[model samples]
Target: MATPIYEFAQIPRVDPAAPARARTRKVRAAGQAPTVGVIYNPRSHRNLGADFDCSLSPHVHIAQPRARAQLPEALADFAAKGIDLLVINGGDGTVRDVLTCGQAIFGDDWPEIAVLPKGKTNALTIDLGIPDDWTLQDAIDALDQGGRVWRRPIAVSPAEDGASAAGMSRVAGFILGAGAFTKATQAGQSAHKLGAFDSMVVAVTGVWALLQSLFASRANPWRKGARMRIGLGASGVPMEHSGHGDPEMRQLLFASTLERLPAGIRPFGALKNGLKLVAVDQISRRTTALIPLVLLGKLRGGLRERGIHQLTASHFTLSIDDQFILDGEAFPAGDYLIGQGPELAFVTP
Candidate 1:
């Protein structure tokens, strides 16, 4: 199990309702060429030393943030310019950083957003149904012609009040997971090195993890999983234990706000919209073998008894004893409040 990196006393709880969001205001006419802002990350996987058609139009302003610290200023400039369409030319990490920094700048009144799948994993774009061949010019053209998909990123912050204000910080992302899910993310890095990405990496990692868990001993970290208490909604209600395996350890815990996941893994079963999560208990080898079927939404009856719990909620609190993966970044093991951020429109081709 991953050890806690920060003492619980050091991390303050955050008010889920406290995110600052200003009211929306009218900015531009429909016929006007939208003022565009692109936050491009040179270090992204696909952009490594590659030159892209950076000029969609002269009005499209681009900022390359070499480090996370430069992100705020870049977003602030866009906010000041009153950009109508904000295009993110990186992957999920870039989108997470931009959203985290832009939260305070644009608030609830965000400009229309676009994602260029330039990173190793572009789950957000996948959920938005963006085409793999989408380019800057395509996104720019779509600003006027494409459809809009409105989504709210999941907000995760320290559970202690006012802790997020003291540099402990909060993050917003489409997907968050812990336990074996984190291990799979680490393994996905190796897959990425082997030239796998997006859905391919997801499928590869899923197979590898399923095989390992199927064959490994119960003590195996992949099967042993993590100790976590997930509380649903404002009342902090504990999830009902299915009594299939270890009560305290969830073998697989994955959550997302995305309507569609990368590999078509319907872990959420028929549930969709809002915040969706699937918590699985350690099960027998037969059940372990059925994981692929479960992921494909093939095995469905009596899943909760089989140790698969799929549900949706407005908000949740995760008090975990292991590091959780948020958009490919490791967040220290601590109590965290998980809820929806502002619903913003994403332009799609």
Candidate 2:
């Protein structure tokens, strides 16, 4: 079956001429109304047929970029207008595209950002405390009165010698997962078919995977996991292996820069800043049954003996023999360098 695309309601398209008018400007000032630019994605699940409040004065500019390639042009136009606040109007995928494309345009000096949680999954919003019903007006108001949360996105790039044939090697996002995580993402599709989304989907798939791993034989896919070598920091020091499982393989590898995650899963344990990852080695069935409690922070100590390891570092490298999921997209198996991007401030209510 072809994959289904979920789009929320879309507002009427903004006038095509508005961008040109918006470009006729200089830089912003302390007292002037801050110039705002919005990158609206009409295809986001919660954005289908939705109407946005477009009457935010003349200083506000909006652009609807239909594809990922168009994101760079849209962001470039915004940068040229000297926008002070960059509003992203979709989900995590849209945010990833904007960050990846805007890197060349904004360099190290990025404008303040706000996100509207109008998509199937808004994990970033969960961390930022953005309301589900937040609108453009709310985002604008928050720009001045709201709290600021600083976060750095995860940067993924192919190793110099491992670049693909097309040389398309770099992308920036917030979440990364491998091993059973890839299967869990595949299972999430089924959860979507059942009308589940957000944390509910996470809870459902996580529970199902736990049961499967707890009961299935050693030969089962969930039990078999994936072959991976994890290296910590710049020196590429090998991750230590627990004697309970295969020394070279990890049953699960999940990494992220966001603090709060959906379903209250604390995969990073107590390590909350920068790049954090949890690697699970193939283990006995008893330990598999206790996995949920481990994630809930109920079980402590002897985790390494149980074949679970959580650590934080400035950066890391992953050499894997299976595909992994970044945000919601699947990337080919190879060597990758994962590190922190610019620390950006996100406006929140």
The root-mean-square deviation over C-alpha atoms between each candidate and the true structure, in angstroms, is: 3.9, 6.4
Alpha-carbon lDDT, every model? 0.82, 0.80
* All candidates: TM-score: 0.91, 0.89
Mark the 10 consecutive residues where model 1 has the least summed lDDT: 1-10
Global Cα lDDT for candidate 2: 0.80
lDDT by residue (tens digit), candidate 2, 1-349: 0013311111112222232223234665666788899999888888885655678689889888777667778888898888889999988878877877776566567889999998787889998889899998899888888999999999887664442311233567898999999899899878988989889989999988898898887667787788998889879899998876677778899999999999898887787888899999988999988888888888878898789998998888889999888777677788788887789999999
Give candidate 1's root-mean-square deviation (CA, Å): 3.9
Q: How many angstroms is residue 168 displaced in model 2 relative to the true structure, after the best TM-score fit?
A: 7.8
Backbone collisions counted per model = 6, 12
